[model samples]
Target: MLVKGQCTICGPELENGLPSTSRFRRLAQDNTLVDGPSLTGYYTSCPAMDREGTTVFWRDGQLLAVDADLASHELFAMDDGQNVMGRTLLLGDGRVVVSLDSEVLAFHSSLSPLAEGPWPCGDANLRGNPVMS
Candidate 1:
């Protein structure tokens, strides 16, 4: 079940619920959280990045993602990341080291995400009709 153009180096597959080896092992042996207190509503105030308000929402098992600052809603997953020239870098990458402006935080793979997914604007352009104007 391989797809074309999937990132080999980045290795993000959460958009599809698939994960690399370590992730698979964690799921198999680790505690599976269910029932009891659930995520009825959760909020976190990430480092602010000017201009306007910033907030994003996503569910544990849900696939769709929504960010408040965006003009229109996007289905891509992730939150509180920067938009580079054109590409987006998820804040939870093991490869990337996060810094807090004046203070530089520790650099370690311990911050790595359990799973990765397609890039921010990751979905392929598959919508619509063939009308040449």
Candidate 2:
């Protein structure tokens, strides 16, 4: 059970790091967290159901990647070798490619984007190797 607490007042930090006034205590029962002290931190608008959303999807709910960027965060995209999300990327040749479970597209720095695609349902389909065949 999760209990939300009200921040009666955020205690001031000590000269070092400790709080000056300790007014709250961790509420637990059987070593389980029943309640916790109200915390003061920055928060962004997040979807309760977004914990399992795509890797680098846009705010509009379009999936551009099949993985998540829990590590590297780009301004508008996240890449996971086999999939990407956030914005439709581009190639110097100006061809718009697409990806699907049955089809996966990739680009080589030396090769043009339209050169080849749908190569084969190899890795991402077999052992879920998003990085290679």
Candidate 3:
């Protein structure tokens, strides 16, 4: 299914997961390594294998969403904030990528989610509105 933006470029889809690492590398080329307080707390000092975190994708410096590391490939976006800003491309491999104004970041996904629903604020807004005012 197409995302919520007008299409600027269209290409054939892929059957396998990621066709090439180059695709990821290219999308992440301009994205800088994320660093800051709000993010650092999500990661730990554990070894790679033991490390767990969520992979974040940013476009034009705005956070897209934290990808849920599950077989369902569920994506958890901030319900209170602006929706994903970049143009989304569904890869043939079934993964999604954003174009233009984008960056990608990762952190331990093992951290138990605080609560389910839209925004981190609470579940009250879940039934009322799409975005917080």
Candidate 4:
């Protein structure tokens, strides 16, 4: 989930009996801190997950893709000088769509195409229902 307030906290947790939680920090290509405990409201974009459990989100002008464990990850910098906000859409063909400050952009996501049924984009669906496909 996309966490706001003092910092941008994004991670995953096991939902079963023994629940475990982990928080990750956003780093630049040079491995420098981009957003974490030192920053406030740095996570400006929404998150989307594919059927295979790969997750995608944005932070500090960069797109982040991570596995379900929130371990292995990749980052893509947006050089268009715009920040992404609102919801992110995962297309049926493995494309991630988001709206920038002044335009719309689509990125080829590492995630697979969405499932056949209704898929969760971010926090909820268009009807504000918390159902997962």
- lDDT tens digits by residue: candidate 1, 1-133: 1111232111112233223211100111234421211221122112111112111222331112222222322233344332221111223342222222233232222222312222221233122111111
Name the regions of candidate 4 deviating beyond 4 angstroms: 2-41, 79-84, 115-124, 127-133
What lDDT would each prediction earn against the true structure? 0.22, 0.23, 0.25, 0.51
Q: Sort by lDDT, best first: what order?
A: 4, 3, 2, 1
Per-model TM-score on C-alpha atoms: 0.18, 0.16, 0.19, 0.55
lDDT tens digits by residue: candidate 2, 1-133: 0011221111111122233322112234445322222222121111111112112212212222221222222223233233222122224442222343345334322212211122111133232112221
lDDT for model 4, on a 0 to 1 scale?
Answer: 0.51
Whose TM-score is higher: candidate 1's or candidate 2's?
Answer: 1
For model 3, residues 19-74, the per-residue Cα lDDT tens digits are: 22211111122444222213211111111100122223332233333322211122
Write model 4 residue lDDT over 76-125, tens digit each, in one string.
67455564465666677767777677677788755785433333433356
Candidate 2, pairs of clashing residues: 55-67, 56-86, 64-84, 64-85, 65-84, 65-85
lDDT minimum window of 10 residues, candidate 1: 20-29
RMSD of each: 16.5, 18.3, 17.8, 11.5
Ranking by TM-score: 4, 3, 1, 2
Candidate 2, superposed: residue stretches over 4 Å from native: 1-60, 63-97, 100-124, 129-133
- Clashes in predicted model 4: 0
